[model samples]
Target: MRHDPLFERLWDGTAQMEEWTAAVSHGAITHVADNIITVHTTYFCGSVTAIRTSEGLVLIDTAKPETAKQTLDVIRSWDDSPIHTVIFTHGHIDHTSGITVIDQEADARGLARPRIVAHRNVKRRMERYEASHGYNSIAQSQQFNKPGYIYPIGQRRPDAVYDDTLSLSVGGERIELFHGRGETDDATFVWLPERRVLASGDFVIWVFPNAGNPRKVQRYAADWATALRRMEALAPAVLIPGHGPVVFGEERAAEMLRHGAEALEHLVRETLALLNRGASLDAVLHAVKVPEAYLGKPYLAAKYDDPEFLVRGIYHFYAGWFDGDAAHLKPPRTADLASELAALAGGAEKLAERATHLSEAGNFRLAVQLVEFASAAAPDDRAIQAIRAAVLRKSIENENSLMGKAFLAVYAREAEQRSKG
Candidate 1:
């Protein structure tokens, strides 16, 4: 019911995203409490929080490496206090990679590098990032629709790692870090008991929780719900999420946390029920839906991660990769299948023509499938490639979520290139 300008701009279609970009570039710093300030960044609505302590400053999370300097500058403007400690809520590049700039700033000030704290699993996550750097790079580029967008591999190692919970006294103010499995296996939520402020890493991001990124690593929906409930129990007066705007007001914060947790819990429960009933993965995906009560909630909109993807993630977590479809158990190569389909449809050109018609008719989902089949069967057909590109471009225009738009844009670009070749 409350007005959220950021959410409004984000969902207002890509053409009007200049305002959102401007918001991130400006990095507005807002003081939520006596000494706590939140810096909202342009990088995916990433946020960095700073707490002025008696000794120095304590920061929770950091912006991405490229934009880290902007975040640091905003904090410096508020207080030039040397950063005593930095807490990484997760190992995501956007959260951890920004430490590089912070380190640089500390060095310039001739102050000791701040102690970096994170979950014990962060080191392993970093190592995995390095090992699978290429795969992650491609996946991230596609996910964000940025071609050649390199995923940050090397991250500043944590000076201290905690398994469950760790308590620290910074400038006589108590800060608690709790490990929770959510968007990532290594996730931490920072709590300031005295200030009643909670910095929920990616777990409480404003956009549908991101618990169902279809292309990324495994997400912990059940654990994510549990963590949200824990935050709700705290009833934080100020809630600063990893991304999006800072939430103020104890009642409002509690409701957001409770409703977010409830949405995930509902999906998990419905998904598990379908699994327990021996429903196929496809059946589960189609059957399990976010309750109608939660659908229109501004926080729970399917702007980024859709409910269907969450259902699939839950199915994979509980039932492994098998979808119970015999044809897919040992499926033929996609190209081979496409070739046969093309033959049955008379020719690849026929399929391409039909795909064009579907695209014009605004049936993008099926249109994309038909176009892909034609392209696979006739990889060198210029007409089919052009048709595929056109259809994907239409899909991109129709997409509401940034992730979906990015993926469709990438496909459209690739198809366009193939057509030109």
Candidate 2:
């Protein structure tokens, strides 16, 4: 099967700038196969797949509100299908938040309201999003590197929710929805055996599987690997992921899925081995490594969630919050701890100076820690705040994953603001 030019660019890693620009503007949509289309945008924020059926259309993972309008326009251009059904591959805003746009489009076209389908736990996920609106808003703002940008709270409730799996006959096409826990507990992967196409949602994104987002809720790496293996067994000819380009050809699709599963399996197994041996969290993080086989795969790059973060997440899932460190069992106030550390180092100024030296030596991780101590020890000190901001900015520059960069940028910007004050 011939791949789209955009897909080729994405697969070869030559379209990063174009992808970013398209995400901010109108993302480019291409026909991956007969009646199957994919919209590629910013990997984390927007990317969706659409399938044209005899009845109307089946959409897997609608893009977010930012690019929803453009996504709708692209779908309309392909065919005036009335969007007979919409499926939320997961509850992530990027995948589910854009249903309203499609709903409105269907209404405008005088078509019946599209039935939204998803796993039943999606409703609970949305409810949790609403419950932790403020906290999520802050975290996403940092995660996306958009200060003060509010996370979308409104969600289009699923019209039909299922537990394990659901088989639907829409427009004479056999659609299968299978539940899998990976990035979110309510994740779903849609398989069209007749079309030989698989919509993988976030389970097999181009980047390393996001089984271990440090700041997010629990992610199930073990279950995630199981789902990937299940999908691999189906031998789909084409794979459309939640993020990144579509995978064409049965050989390529299987390779991507199997390797993605292997990456997660390596992390989970290694992390568990260390934990079982009573290793500390830090030790487990350093011990678990991505297999050499996956290191060279374009689809398995650590541009999003790296192996260390995934290991930490697996550790958290298996163990409790405590890292088996007794001193942290009942830690002193951060300010009090910083004060004592400052006194031992002579003063807050000394800590700040040492942090600056570390930053200069390209030891950003330790520099950030030392600066945090300085900031806490001298909350009102502009000099300490300045040092912290500088160190954080350097950390952000050196980071590869968008999540890490966004978080560091948010902190650096905050420190800069505090210094100004």
Candidate 3:
């Protein structure tokens, strides 16, 4: 295999943080170990792993619909083995959407289709998605910053479903699939006992685990941490993560897993402690800080999901939806409150001016709050609309995670359109 400097640095644990991000976005295939080929599919898309076995290739994840064909093509170029089995790390579209392409390819080659495997809850999750198609469509669109992008409701169903643990042997290699609840309820992480290579599907994303996605369903932070520790126990020599660069050494892989688990564990423990004392969600969200030990680690970067967001998800997992604030239990409509505030501040325009001042003073969080009120109060005021758009744009600049940026981008666009009107 040709040598890749970035891949080498990643393997040697010398790659810079920016290089790690670059590796995830760069669609490249690297043979990290014997019988293990990792494909970095595309920017912001899930990865595909192909394990060359004596029988055939055992594939894990097929990437998203857009990059699935390319992912398979790259794998096929390396080896023309028929895919014996395709395992889903979870039911997420990015992981499951490529099965259709794989099936079609098998038919074209006159080969038998691969058996699909996933946790039983994957089917239930798919059913729920189908039932709430409209809502998912909108939510996904907003999440990805793709307007009018309909969520792909029709996904290839799993042929075999396991509840807790499933073991498979193909061509003399032992592959163990353990059900883990992390980014999703039906998450799975694969372990190759023979090679000691762990394929952590979304469970060990290169960035901070997506355990606290604000726009998604409830993420199990405690369970996610446990899963990481479980993977760490295996002392995998190599780690092929769901999205980023591969880890080469046993010590490096174990440390990364341990750090990820520790970060989530810290959040869960601290957040629950505050909640137990009857602290409000707002107080807990601000008070619970990410551990200093995990800071500056390449794998624990908050580029995708922030730690504060994780705290919110932790609150949701243990406590109910109510944030312990009585005012929020059955709060007045936001527009009503915004109108009253605008009137109290003389007018919406005056509030917009104050928001501009706050924004200029580097107080973007408060600036957006004020501008949103102004926009809501005087919807027809072009000045207020412009100010809202500007403030939201500034917030987007200040944000680190894609979730925050995408959501803020949505509101900014709305304000921009309204400002024109």
In angstroms, how far off is 14's CA in candidate 3? Answer: 8.3
In model 3, residue pairs whose N, Cα or C atoms come closer than 3 Å (at least 3 residues apart or on different chains), thus clashing, are: none
**What C-alpha RMSD separates each model from the true structure?**
2.8, 2.0, 2.2
Q: Model 3, 1-421: lDDT tens per residue?
A: 2446875665454875466556555467768678788888553677788989899999999889888888888888888999999999999988999898999999999999999999999999999999989989888898889999888877878999999999999887789999988999999999988788899999877778887777778889999999999999999988888887777788788899999999998999999899999999999988999976686676787878889999999998899899999999999999999999988999889889999999989998889999999998999888789889999998899898888999899999999999999
lDDT of 3 at 372: 91
The CA root-mean-square deviation of candidate 3, after full C-alpha superposition on the true structure, stands at 2.2
Better of 1 and 2 by TM-score: 2
Off by over 4 Å in 3: 1-4, 7-27
Q: How do all models score by TM-score?
A: 0.93, 0.95, 0.95
Per-residue lDDT of candidate 2, residues 19-101 (tens digit): 64465355667576778888765666556777888998888878888878878887777877688888999998888878888
Lowest-sum lDDT 10-residue window in model 1: 9-18
Q: Judge candidate 3 against the unseen true structure and give its global Cα lDDT, from 0 to 1.
A: 0.87
The window of 10 residues in a row where model 2 has the poorest summed lDDT is: 17-26
Residue 8, candidate 3: how far off, in angstroms? 6.0
* Error at 376, model 2, angstroms: 0.4
- The reply for model 1, stretches above 4 Å from the true place, is 1-21, 43-45
